[model samples]
Target: MQNTPENDHEQDAAPSKTRRKKDMHALQEIGEQLVELDPKKLNEFDLPEILLDAIHLARPMTKHGARRRQMQYIGRLMREVDMRPIQEKLDSWQQVSVHQTARLHQLERWRERLLTDEHALTEFAEKYPVADLQHLRLLIRNAHKEKAAEKPPKSFRLLFQALQATITEV
Candidate 1:
């Protein structure tokens, strides 16, 4: 029951093994996420040649066992590279996509309000001083006419594009 040097060393070794396992599993999960990414987006990450080759090979793998083995190989390769930069690049890519989605939603909301409410134009112009109020008015009128006639939403699409441009410019 007495504290001993051997017992202290055993305690230290136990945590190191557990930590290594956890780190390995986390790396494997990251590798799996990398495999799921679009090839174009995957190319943006500066992965090692071996890991990149493994990912490319895994992409066409149909059999579950082959894919799993490839993923394990990718994880082992990942351990050789510094993961912090790769993690940061992935985080930034995700954030950019999220921001783009939010911006699209905002533009859609503005377009909807412009179609349904008369006061929305004034609000939009006030919020975006650089926007072309005259052009927006024309598009809104055309969009309303298209809606009444149940025609194709060409003007509505244009209005959405204008809104997007104006919002992004600001």
Candidate 2:
């Protein structure tokens, strides 16, 4: 016999414990993969062919061990690379225009609209009504609050109160 609507509702409301565990594991794997795609990894894959050919010459094997060994080599290189110094240098050498700051504020507001009001965010992030955008919502919400706090609020409360007082007196 097919499950009744009530039974189906319960089934969906309480997914098997195993299914939740599997989903959590899948999300963890995706997070790890994203963290591993560092700027150095991107550059290594995108560098000019001549430079790549030279690096390839130093490692003349197409063996499966190459990837494992190269990762270890990269880990070592990462320790020696001071990214903060480079970032500081870049920041010192570059300037942000007022337009860029305004654009950032606009992005912040969009993130807020997506977050505190999540049905819309889910549609945007997943392109489906059933999708969850909870994590993104939290991230954007916090950032939006921070950005809004940075700006002085426009003054309308006194004028609003004066108008209200006049109307009430009338």
Candidate 3:
């Protein structure tokens, strides 16, 4: 007999995806609620919470628009977030960050020790690299003068395709 949808689903057609389906159903309900909510009801919710939740529930935006929008957000939030409490949190964060940085820096010095000691790399990568991990932070100071205004670099795939075209000509 030709199998029906019910029979196919029942015969362990791949491991069950019920959890994923449930999550999608819950998200659909949330999206329907957003469309259904009155502006006044949305306004009654905490402004920041509402903004964050609405953005989270919205469909993904185009990549270029999303990055520009995030930069705009950081600029706006930088102005509005309470400075002193934010500074205090940042200060604590800085201290923890510095401590972690120093610890990593010291461990990086010991990488050779890892090969000799056997447990060194395992313990380090598992916990934290014993090395300074200063990420490449950026700032476009005097952007108009420097002509270094910030934007994301082009996609690697595009770069590779361009390189391939240049290389293949006889």
Candidate No. with top TM-score:
1
Model 1: clashing residue pairs?
A: none
| Winning model by lDDT | 1
- Go through the candidates in order and give each one's C-alpha lDDT: 0.90, 0.45, 0.43
Error of 1 at 116 (Å): 1.2
Off by over 4 Å in 2: 1-8, 40-170
Estimate candidate 2's RMSD in Å.
23.0
**Colliding residue pairs in candidate 3:** 104-130, 104-131, 104-132, 105-131, 105-132, 107-130, 108-130
Instruction: Kindly list the per-residue Cα lDDT of model 1 for residues 111-166, writing each as its tens digit.
Output: 99998899999999899999999999999999989989999999999999999899
To one decimal, what is the Cα RMSD in angstroms of model 1 from the true structure? 2.5
lDDT of 2 at 158: 27
Model 1: residue 154 alpha-carbon error in angstroms? 0.8
Residue 135 error, candidate 3, Å: 35
TM-score of each: 0.84, 0.20, 0.29
Question: Between prediction 1 and prediction 2, which has the larger TM-score?
Answer: 1
